[model samples]
Target: MYQADIAIVGAGMVGLALARSLKEADLSVILIDTTPIAKPLSEQPELRVSAFNAANKQVLEQLGVWQHLDQQRLSAYTQMQVWDQDSFGRIQFSSEEMGTSELGHIIENQSLVNALHHQVSQQPNVQMLPSTRIAKVLAGQSETMLMLDSDEVVSCRLLVGADGANSAIRKYANFPLTFKDYGHTAIVATIKTAAPHGKVARQVFTPTGPLALLPLSDPNLCSIVWSQNSQQADELLALSNSDFAKALQVAIEGDVGEIGVESARMHFPLTMRYARQWLSDGLVIIGDAAHTIHPLAGQGANLGLQDAFALADSLQKLAAEQAAFHQARQLRAFERARKSEAVKMIAAMESFKQLFGGSHPLKKLIRGVGMCTADAIPVIKQRFITQAMGW
Candidate 1:
């Protein structure tokens, strides 16, 4: 039997970050996933990216994972602009108001995963099992056992599910989940604007949905997440790259100037997922396995990172106390805290979605008044910036 003190079922950014954060806990960690541990960094920028706030970045810096990242690939956005295409609702925020150098950094998702993988692999207490699958799991009152497809068994006191929104571990553990379709499909791709992005992130809400133009390392390059109803998304997806670019240019009303689709467009349906129980006897779930929210505000990844950090803290304390037998019960506080945060985030996203979704006259008026009110009040804008910064 192969065993470790803790076994993480997914080797993505969240799982690897958990393992890396436990380096000082003096406990063994084994990470498993069907995919390779470190995905190859492509010559061109990857289409998948995340807007990491200052809090998560500070934690990464503390873990030494930030240093492993290529500085050139990181885009520190100092400003943001949000407006509703159907109305005159517009709000702008700047890092200068918060006395910070950056509001956030838009990093390619794969790049951060590779950085975490690099950092975690070097820790003597951590082990990696890549290209492997768990054929079965048995969670007892005191321990969890993962049976691998290779006919190997892993016995650990605790098992963590970081697989993703459709987590197999969560399924195996029978963790109850609540999910809802957002009725939106997100189209993502790398894009080039006619003019420089000026290190600013911009989002525009249309009658269909919202479009986000996140600045990339290059001034002319950006990554876009365009969410719309499935029907409209399909219509747009059917268009050729050039035509799609033209459609995009018209969507944001040429906010970024002439848009050019620089990469193949890929899309996925948007859904919200929340696991009612984050932990059970000998088993637990975190990250996307626990909760997922809309991409409108770009807080999903940050929430996952927060989960990892919070759980790491709890587990470290448990290790220091030399807890055993009833260790699962000790994690209730951790689960409760993270779950509460997830609920709050989900509610916030839902409010934003409903408030800005359509062309209702009342909603449009509210959005316009709200944005103008926020922009005019320096204190209100500062509070918004602080909240977004996770400060």
Candidate 2:
């Protein structure tokens, strides 16, 4: 059996980040994940990507991961353009209005993960366990023990479930969740274009769903996230690379001239899930394990990163007060501090998804009015920019 002061059930970004944060405070930490880490950031090719808001970048800097990332590979979007199809509705945002240098950075997902893992590896107080599956989880009076597939047991004062949407630890804790399937799938891939993205992230809303082009490190290369019904997504993915690129070029209104596919397309079901509770007697859930929001706004990873930061801060505060880390009161403080933000984000995404997906005449009217209103109100835009940057 392996014993530690804290055990994290997921070695993904959120888990690894929290582990690094905890170890910085001199706490013993163990990071376990079912899937083995593939490779280091510098050695891996681009597979998936994430947009890092300013706040998240600060967190990464604090964890020493940002310094490990190649500076040239980071893309900063300073502007955004959003519009709806078949309408004169459009909304635009500029970082200048927010008094910021840039809106956010677009980073390769694998590279970001590897950077965090590298930081964790360098931390002496943190133990890394990969390709290890949790077979059983038992919560004791003062500690929790996880039985692994390797027949080893891990005991710790606290347990964190960061294992993603279908979290086994969440199931073992009997956490309740509300789920809604949007009857849609999201297609993600890279696109090469003749025109530069100009540090702008654009999203076009259509009757089916949203089609977004987020700027990549290469000025001419952008990442596309197209949302649509299962049938349409199936057809799109089934098309040949050339045909798919042609169709996608039109879907995004061909704003970027001469678009072509640069990577294999991937599709994932669109869903919204929220756990009824975020904390239990001896366990805490973070990241996708606690909530799953619509990716339409590119805020999923940001929200998860916020969860990790909040928990890490809360625990640090308690430890500074010389309080026990595993106390229900201490854990509840973490939950209470984050629950409001989590619920607000989840609701906002759901509302946006529904408002954009509906076909009612009133809904169409509202969409147009909403964009115009947002554009007209400086306070609204400021608040929007603030929220988007996770401020």
For model 2, residues 27-136, the per-residue Cα lDDT tens digits are 78889988886365544236577888999898788778899876778889999899887666788989999888999998887777777887788888888899998888
Worst 10 residues of 2 by lDDT: 38-47
Score every model by TM-score.
0.98, 0.95
- Screening candidate 1 with a backbone cut-off below 3 angstroms (N, C-alpha, C), the clashing residue pairs are none
lDDT of 2 at 169: 87
- Residues 169-220 of candidate 1 have per-residue lDDT tens digits of 8898787889999999999999999999999999999989999999999999
lDDT of each: 0.91, 0.85
What CA root-mean-square deviation does each model show from the true structure? 1.1, 1.8
